[model samples]
Target: MTVIVRDFRPEDADAVSRVRRAALPFEVTTPRSVLFHVESANPAGKYRLLIAEMDGEIVGTAQVGVAYESGTPGQSYANPQVHPGRRGQGAGGLLLRTAEEHLAAEGAVEVYAWVLDEPEFRAFAERRGYRPTRSAHFQRLDLAGGTLPELPARLPPGVELRTAADYTADPRPMFQADAEVTSDEPSDIGAELDDYEDWLAHTWNNPLLDLGLSTVVLVDGEVAAFTAAHTDGERRYWSGMTGTLRAHRGHGLAKLAKTDSLRRARAAGCTDAFTSNDAENGPMLAINKWFGYEVCATEVRHVRTFG
Candidate 1:
């Protein structure tokens, strides 16, 4: 069977989403989100969504892009996935080669990809000249059936909990908090969140973002911590981000934000909750563990530098 890789078309949304969800079940993805991601991608990212077809059926997908927001130049990423049932047909390799060619042509000096921590997955990447680097975990919690700690009888004096909806009139505080916390997040490519308009468009306006379920913590009218939430408008909810400002760390505020967000998600009929974090982030990992989140899968970041 001949497998061919090509640019994603508007009609490929459903197929692309299907392949992505089948391959990475822990992440939240839908046809709408797929389209939005492609359309709203920052111009400088040079994002390309590729689809692999075999005998007229899409069996694999890849997202290739320059890390324009990264402080370092020439850093790019290519994440490819093939449907489990279609893995042996050479679609993944073809997609990878196509994505790499596109990235290299776009001036990428190095490419980073996340490969499943499974032996075969690691071997595949290694054979392709990628080397293992840092690792991250996809954690899940049974929001509907599992036990969740009761909310503190009373939040610490001067601390208050609010939803993202509360800032409908003005989201500057939330943006400020996100910028502060995100700047400190552990990432191979540093994210420079200096553009408020970009944040408002790509983040605040995203369709999957569940404003009502996202919890924000405030200390005396100032944003301290927040847990951004995303849902498929059904049983699945995802913690888009959970962080506390540097000045507010160690007060258990991050935990508080996540806990409140998860509870609100459960109340909204979400049956499962998902989140991920860098393996080295002990504080967040411990907080997730406290909420009974178990590691569902692990992905190791792999990098290949072009000579």
Candidate 2:
């Protein structure tokens, strides 16, 4: 009944995915994405996927990495996910300790992790010297039969809706829009998206990104708003990001992009749609609620500063 923590191997992708899906059912992930996380990691990230194996079975994992994209120094994250059925075992604690050690060695001064709002999970993190900071919610929309509002009959003059695939020739416009909107997103460790090649490789070319289902709003031929979609290629859809450029914020562009994307998803036979946002992001949360998305689960961000 001993649990051991080790580094993720090429062959352990499936096991890692299983643990993640079991622990965080609201998020969408595949083995390919799991492998991509490791292979396409930025050298500066110092990314390490730690796995906890017990008696020859992998039970948990921690995604540990330095927040290299952030302008701030010493920001890092390590999220541990253990299979729900295997939680009583010591897999989670071992994985956390291993992740912290790895992150600390990589020059991390403060490590952030998401702890489930449940008492046991919160207690687990608190006992390890982590303190609650901000919270986030995982919301789900029933793409098949839910109250996804129909696309507006008139999309406001000079505004056009297009799929991300339309930018196949050159995605710099989408990249520009994404960067500006993302720069405004709330986070303890903010990211700066300045590299075009990195965005093309890691985002536009990612296997999970559904180009056809992702809807973008263009106003006067400019990327005004967009919703990036991720799917399991069958029935599950996830809103990886939905954002509106600063200039277009008060114009209902966010809702327009999401409405069009949701209808597209339902038409594509996706049964469920998942999304998440920081608790303080009231505007996006309100739009999601308008689309009938219900908060399925909440997780609080926890951080520990190493002296």
Tens digit of lDDT per residue, candidate 1, span 1-307?
9999999999999999899999999999989999999999988889999999999999999999999878899999999999999997899889889999988999999999999999988998999999999999999999989998888999888999999999979988888988888888888878888888899989999999999999999999899999999998889999899999888889989888888888888888999999999999888999999999999999999999987
Model 2 spans with C-alpha error above 4 angstroms: none
Q: List, residue by residue over 12-34, the lDDT tens digit for candidate 2.
A: 99989888999999999999899
Model 1 whole-model lDDT (C-alpha atoms): 0.92
Q: Tell me model 2's lDDT, rounded to 2 decimals.
A: 0.92
Cα lDDT of all candidates, in order? 0.92, 0.92
Pairs of colliding residues, candidate 1 = none
The true-versus-predicted C-alpha distance at residue 135 of model 2, in Å, is 0.2
Using Cα atoms with residue i matched to residue i, what is each candidate's TM-score against the true structure?
Answer: 0.98, 0.98
